[model samples]
Target: MHTESQLARLHTADLLAQADAHRIAAAAKPPVELRTRVGWTLVELGLRLASAPGPVPATA
Candidate 1:
């Protein structure tokens, strides 16, 4: 059985995953209005890169 903390962590992870998926999808197909906005493409690219799974940060 999972502890309360574990369950909470799992929920948080799931939410993060869903958010990342949305970000990636948005980046893949940005809105026409967004295309006209200055620096919007760069913002989308930044979100895509940030959402990608990578090495965990070193705990101090």
Candidate 2:
């Protein structure tokens, strides 16, 4: 009986933890428009960095 109670309590705690984690994740996620803009900005920055010229080698 005590073991069963302990198990139930543990199960409840786990469910509560999962709910909290889901709520936090939902809250932390950016809106679609903001995510899109940030994604595009990162892509543009990556392209610019990729296309940037390297330093010229010094002639001996």
Candidate 3:
């Protein structure tokens, strides 16, 4: 008979395998609008930081 710990491990392993499959599927999808939006946002942020005056205060 499977002990509780063994059953738990089996369940966890199954979940992880499913998650890995999902991640691979997501990676295979074509680039969507959100990717462009996020990329442009990063570019804008970089430009703003480049244009900003003065050094940022260092925290202790």
Q: lDDT by residue for model 3 over 1-60, one digit each (tens)?
A: 999999999999999999999999999998789889999999999999899897879999
Clashing pairs in 3: none
Number of the top-ranking candidate, with TM-score as the measure: 3
Candidate 1 has which clashing residue pairs, if any? Answer: none
For residues 1-60, what per-residue lDDT tens digits would candidate 2 score against the true structure? Answer: 569889999999999999999999999987679788999999999999999998989999
Q: Is candidate 2 or candidate 3 better by TM-score?
A: 3
| Native-to-model Cα distance after best TM-score fit, residue 49 in candidate 3, in Å | 40
Note the Cα lDDT for every prediction shown: 0.90, 0.94, 0.96
Best by lDDT: 3
Q: Over 4 Å off in model 1, which ranges?
A: 33-60
Q: Compose the digit string of candidate 1's lDDT tens values, residues 1-60.
A: 999999999999999999999999999995677456757878888999999999999999
How does candidate 2 fare on TM-score? 0.48
Candidate rank order under TM-score: 3, 1, 2
